[model samples]
Target: MTRARRKPMVAPKLFSEIDRYDEANSARLGLICIQERIPSGYTRWDREYNLDGRDARLTCISPGEYGGVPHGLDGDFATLLNVLYLEQGSPESGEVHTTAYQLIQRAGFPDSGQYYQSLQESLDRLKGATYTASESWRDHRQKRWTTVKFNIIEQIDSDTEGGTAFGVGTTLKIRLARPVVQSLRERYVKPLDLTFVMSLKRSLTRSLYRMLDAHRYDPANPQEPAAALRLPLLQWARECKLVEEVPARVRRNLESAHAELIDRGYLKSVTYEGRRAETIIVYEFGDLPATAPAPEPMIEVVPDSPVTEALRRRGVAHPVARRLVADFGENHVTVRLETFEAMIAAGYKARNPSALLVDVIKDQEGKYAALGTSALPAAVAPHARISKVVGDEDVDALSATLDTEFRALPPAEQAARAVTSVRMFIGKELREGHYRSLLRAVQAGDVDALELQREATRAAAELRLPEFAEGLRRAYSEP
Candidate 1:
């Protein structure tokens, strides 16, 4: 008795049959297994030379298609394997083979001769079935196989690569297809714009370097290469939605741009520090617009002492005189403080004061600390009706308190207040009676308000804020 046929170790799986056929046919006939959307394809799939060059039937398998045959055929194990031999010539002339197979001996189908039979019987069954080969086929009287006029793109391989040359790149240009761009316009374009800003931080660092170089200054060393200028640059960069950690190369490119600005006379060296010969004076580049001038305290004190005339010959401003007198009651007192400090550090502290004053100017001008001050506190400061005593003894205590308040609130609340401060006049608007209704509308889960919070967080974190806010407004508000 015949030994019982061995069983397949696992049940049939999706694509397992297709996978076996592809591998076996590809290996036997030198067909390629290429990705469906890839930049290349198999010999017969190339199109110019096959008998079925324009047929839809040929093209479907050319790129390869999926989904299994219907289950109604039951245990029938047949496949039609078409190979367009590229080494053969044109449709009227070359050898093209389309063979039908009745696959047998798959261990799971041991008793199924009905499924795998002779080619004649297979052809009869296929013809009897509703699905016949899609295009016209003719039996060759002079050759062993028949030919079909199916859609196939063929190629001529060149001998240099051991096969005929199939111009895949050219054919793709003539016949390639793309999914519609309009269909993805909203889904792709919006997130791409958002991510665009996220990627801009790197670019902004280059701008910072140019801003630094516009002043005719060079980084003295790598460790503090930008120590002289980084802080203010960083502050403004943040305001522009640029952040720190921009690469060093970007920093250098910015420096070079600023240098170009200097070369064009948009910037000038305005003042010197240290001895007249040893000093360095930095200037802003002219290509860039000048921001509001940095603030300098305008203190006027005329000393009633003769020594005031003596100090006047020096370039010292009178404010320095008053600060000296205010710091120390006598001119001699100012001299003593300077002399002692110099004796200890030998002019190091005094040397950098002018540069440090540049920062002090920008700070006092109100650009540096506005988020936690000025526009913010000015909003509610009038309505709160609260006055807490602030002392010069504690310096920035008032600003500090206000900053503490601003930081303590969630970003969303801060954003709402910011919009309110700029747009709403409380008594005029609130007194009109629609104000509370509007406030409730915002508070009752406003989408606009939430969007504003996201924008503000991006602005504050990336440092873009109101300047870049306009660009992003259409992002959330569009119909």
Candidate 2:
């Protein structure tokens, strides 16, 4: 007699599938994810490299207020900007429309109101960062080197008011920087395997994978991805923006990322050659036993892990499963799985079973807090989460970063950029008339653009989601 297949002991997930994203030009800079952690009190970074036989330099300045230079989640948000740009029909520049909740879900962040605050924080940082490329900025369209300075994101407009959190459907408009557009128009890009990239837990691994992609994958023959990559150790460290330049320390820094990538099959082996800074790190891609498949549109290039398999069994997509497991730990995820299954056994019907499962795992806003049949250990409590306040500093930090960058721009460009901001006042809020006139001075190149952008940028971030409003109120109620 044939036995029935085992029922999946998990609930279904509800999320729209995001296609693979096209990323261009980031590979050339390779400074976005230099170090996993930016050193405290660090606000400026400068590095010199040779480009096309000419000396070039990259300098990034971040105000100490806006969480230092655009590091960590800043880079991830940059990648997501690319993804969202492509997802929102074809715009390499100009505005791509989206909502905050959609960004969180598509980026595989847990569905929670608290994340809405973090989302805005990352967005603010991206806009706050100023990158100066002295002859290092590759004009891909012109096929020559050029000097330029710009923020990661050009502009932001959102349906926000009253310095509060936004709701799920709050619309947002984000414009891409010109250099990014030029690269895309010139086809200096590759389809990033986000499925694989997002699966890797640490940002270091993700950064390494992207940088290596730049080294291994050629856009001309995008199908034939190279299987090997070799680079000098200390040079690679510099390229990665590692805080510590010492060889041993660099290796120690990359130890975990290297291990994760190898375990995930992005690399079969990573071996070093020679001595000191000149030591060459060689990477062999894929598994020895299995021949690697040609790069696909959304190629994962990874074997299924047990946690991923478990999540997949519950109807979560492969990439999403890995992302969820990576975002939340595997150890406690299994418990979430069991809790979800228990709900199913108890006849708790769900419109989106997988979403319910994830919500249970995330203990999103304590919605499923009381559903626990048995209380988990303090270390394993799913509902337990740290609620970090979006303090005054977080709100006020980027004003300096935005102000300094605007002032640094030449009069002509600054006026042009300001006019762009002024045009956004077309059909906004109650302050449309008053604010439009205020920023119109900047648009006319009369007054400073700092005050207007500072307020506008802060407004964009201020829309607190209804779920977290009470918590925010309580926090602000203190002192």
Who wins the lDDT comparison?
A: 2
Candidate 2, residue 143: lDDT:
65
RMSD of each: 37.4, 19.2
What is the TM-score of each predicted model, taking all chains together?
0.14, 0.56
Off by over 4 Å in 2: 1-19, 165-170, 218-224, 287-479
- Judge candidate 1 at residue 64 and give its lDDT: 18
lDDT of 2: 0.58
Lowest summed lDDT window (length 10), candidate 1: 168-177
Q: Candidate 2: minimum summed lDDT over ten consecutive residues — where?
A: 7-16
| Candidate 1 positional error at 334, Å | 34
Q: What is candidate 2's TM-score against the reference?
A: 0.56
Give one digit per residue, the lDDT tens place, for model 1 in 371-401: 2323332322221111111123333564566
